[model samples]
Structures are given as structure tokens and as C-alpha cells.
Target: MFQRGPGVPTVEVGALSADAYLLDVREHDEWEAGHAPAAVHLPLSELIARLDEVPADREVHVICKVGGRSAQAVQFLNAQGRDTVNVAGGMLAWAAAGLPMQAAPGTEPFVA
Candidate 1:
């Protein structure tokens, strides 16, 4: 189980939806390697500046290489009044769960 931070929530990586408002917060290199097939690529470095792009009404699932960055993002976004959850175990767990992923064009798929 994940440590809950104040208002932040968490969901198992296997339970995520491809159609939900999934946010990938990994770095560019990590993203370039591969990511959730339907996730929106909004690196954490750009999250604050691009906060407007995140839907305030929807429950957002934030993910990174591991749960750390997404957990931090969940904390921040929750403070901003956006309903967010950390994708527990992140990409590694997602891949382990046999979830679909997409890599950069011409590259082999692998979780970064």
C-alpha cells in the first residue's frame, strides 16, 4: 500500500483506464522510450506552467518511472483542487500488468 499524502489518492496501475485522463510525468528521455498508449505526455517539469491544460473536473491519474514523482504531483494537484491520484508502482508496474504501451516511431517498446 502507498503512503497517503493529505488529500492525494492512489490507484493500482492495473486498474487504470486507457480512456481516463492519464497524465505521464516522466522526463523526455523516459517518455521517448515508451509510455501508456493513451496517456497525455505532460512532463512534471512542465506541469505547473501547463496546469491550465489539465482538466479540473476529471479525476486525473498521474504516473512516472516510479510512484515518487507522481505522488508529489498528486500532492500538488490536490492542493490546487484538482482531483488526482498517483498511479501506484508507475510504468514498471503498468508494463508488468501487461498494459498496452507505445514507443517513439521506429523504436521497440519498453517501459523507461
Candidate 2:
């Protein structure tokens, strides 16, 4: 059986708490295009190498362009005993909710 951690809880954008740590697992280009305002860019490719950067005490909301990569990431993190949850529907859902997206510092607004 897959055991879930105590802190991690998957939630929709509308249900996400402002205080939660949102981990964006999309690629650099995709993240630069647009992402949740509260999200931290940690592209899936580098996640394992940077696992130590994630705080173990806080809940981590993992997200991708859709939900595939995030789901995969959540599984991996869970197996590694890290607290993580997949943000269902991902940035697409967040955008559909009319949530605000922050551009990279000093960069132009994301076109996509």
C-alpha cells in the first residue's frame, strides 16, 4: 500500500492555502511562460538533485503544466519519505481559475 505523509494534501488551485509551498515541476521554458504566483520553480529534471532544498516540515504542493509530471514527482517524493501532493489539473487549472501568474524577475510577461 502507498502510504501518504501527514502534511501533504492534494488540492485544487481554488482550494490551495496561501501558506503552502507550491512546487512547480514544469520545465524552465514552461515555467517562464507562466505559473502560479505562489509556486517555486524546481523543474522536474532537477528535482532529485535538489531534493535537499525542499523543507521536510512544510506541505509541498507539486504541479506541472497539466498533472502528469506532478503526479510522478509526488510518487517519487512519497517513496523517498518526503511530504508531497500532486496539484490536480496543474497550471492549466490555476489559469482557468483566473489566478495571477508571476513572470521571472525583470522578464517580459509570459506569452503562453
Please give the CA lDDT of all the candidate structures: 0.86, 0.79
- Each model's backbone clash number: 0, 0
User: Whose lDDT is greatest here?
Assistant: 1
Instruction: Give stretches of model 1 more than 4 Å off.
Output: 1-7
Poorest 10 consecutive residues of model 1 by lDDT?
1-10
- Give per-residue lDDT, candidate 2, residue 25: 84
Q: What is the C-alpha RMSD of each candidate to the true structure, in Å?
A: 3.4, 4.4
Residue 43 lDDT, candidate 1, scale 0-100: 84
Clashing pairs in 2: none
Locate the minimum summed-lDDT window of 10 residues in model 2.
Answer: 1-10
Question: lDDT by residue for model 2 over 53-109, one digit each (tens)?
Answer: 777887789999877778878887877888888887888888788888877788754
